[model samples]
Target: MATVEQNVSEFRGIIFLVRILFHADIYREALLSRLIILTLFSYFFQNDWSQAVTKFYRTPLLYERSYLNFLYLQNKFSSTKKYKKVTHCLFDLDGTILDSEIIYHKAIQKICERYGKTYTKKLQNQLYGVTDRQLSIGVVSALKLPISVDDFEKQMTELVQKNLTDSPFKEGAERLLWHLSTSKIPIALVTNSTDQAVQMHAKARPKLFSLFHHKVCITDPEVKRGKPEPDMYLLGAARFTPKANPTQCLVFEDSVVGVEAAVRAKMQVVMVPDYRIDKELTLKATIVLKSLLDLDPTLFGIPAFKDGVKRGS
Candidate 1:
């Protein structure tokens, strides 16, 4: 005699075969008769005549239940979509469009070393997203240096400018910008960097930098406060030809402060943070991506790349 597991397996196999036959187009006209015969066979095998007929009847019902579930899932998922439409795009410069944060790190570290203090990673992480003045103050305080914030800022700026002369676009930056430009989407560069820093960056890559419809620097007269404050982003939006509604703008940022600024401006934000950033800090953004390279333009209602078009090609 077969074991209980073997019996169950055999019964399942028979039920599967019956289901297949019942649904076959060629056997459709004889399905009723075959079902009856299969019910009798089940009764003979189980030696429970009444229960066997009920079990066999439930088989078709079970298949019907499964089919209905499959349809429900298909319709449910098909109705869902992730991307939203935006009229304008705003991007932060350092660590977002440009790979300049590491240069800033080196500059600040060199300054800290001059004061016989070390620039710890903990301090760097804390200052990652702060504005220029805020960062200068933070660095001075963190190192317990006796220098004024202005002096520290001046020294760091000199060091950063030297290092930033040939800074490359961050991964995915050039491709996405070119796509948006080709598609005729309005784009702006909004950064907390000073006017001088922005000029230095533009000097390095004038052709690429000239693509923006506007560039809003932290020193712009209209910007009352630096990020984590909405002033800069709001100003950037107003500079557009038709003046975008905050909701109609999408901001790309790589800092928690920038994300917060965009959110406060009532714009949707996509954060592509550095690897050292804490994951929890990114939760406030509308979406977080690993890098600009992983961004799906279609998610923002922008045209997606053609299937065979390689990035940056």
Candidate 2:
């Protein structure tokens, strides 16, 4: 009996050792694979590995896949983190939440016409969701028009004020705003529009402005860089409570640039197409709805609807 027990103990110890070795082997391989990838990438992309590591660490990833991988690793093993609760909706005005696209185009059209430059569909599409400075710079570059940034900004501001005063809301915008307000889900206006433009548009249309008011996150020239830079969205995220994880907020946008910004911020987004800007927005947006009015309780995961009030009816 004693010899049999000794044999059994030896077998159990051997099994335990083997299991440990197996786990160690898997871990080692994973580490080695990552190292090999990093080494190869550094070698091909940069001549010096040490210099590459330093430069890479200092800068943000330029590729979407790499950024996604970084986010995955960040969320996987992080301790003492409270996930964000989805209580806020970040809206893009002009195009997404309101029907001010015509006003914007008209303003640009008038300016372009003054300079003997045409505002074509192709050009407008290229300008969607770009920063005010970027848009002005681009138009100036394209038309070879002699316009300073300051002068262009002032002119655009005047034109926007003149054109947007009576701008109408997009279908279902009022209802959406009323519902969101009643629900007490905080709504912040995140726009690439300058603060002056935001004020002008808001003054022209109070209903839209009121929905955004203390909740506004305007693209100020002062604080951070513009969209595609991730600064504005990061600022929005920072304004919320520490627990307001990017996952909790919903970004409503209408342009590819807007979608890219929200994606980098790790927020979910709904895209309302800017028909004028016919970019392939479906690729980046989480949900590409035909109209904002189409959004219902079911869309937001509010499952309290009775059969009588079926969604999309």
Error of 1 at 5 (Å): 54
CA lDDT, every model vs. true structure = 0.77, 0.62
Where model 1 places Cα greater than 4 Å from the true spot, the runs are 1-82, 307-313
Q: lDDT tens digits, residues 68-187, model 2? A: 332223222232343334667787777776677788778888888888888887777888778767878877777777787678767877887776756777776666766677777767
Q: Which ranges of candidate 2 are over 4 A from the true structure? A: 1-85, 204-208, 216-222, 241-243, 276-280, 303-313
Write one digit per residue (lDDT tens) for candidate 1, span 89-191.
Answer: 9999988888888888889989988889999988989999787789999989878898999999999888988888667788888888888998889999999
Backbone atom clashes (below 3 Å) for every candidate:
0, 1
Report residue 244 deviation for candidate 1 (angstroms): 1.0
- Which pairs of residues collide in candidate 2? 84-245
Question: Candidate 1, 169: how far from true, in Å?
Answer: 1.4
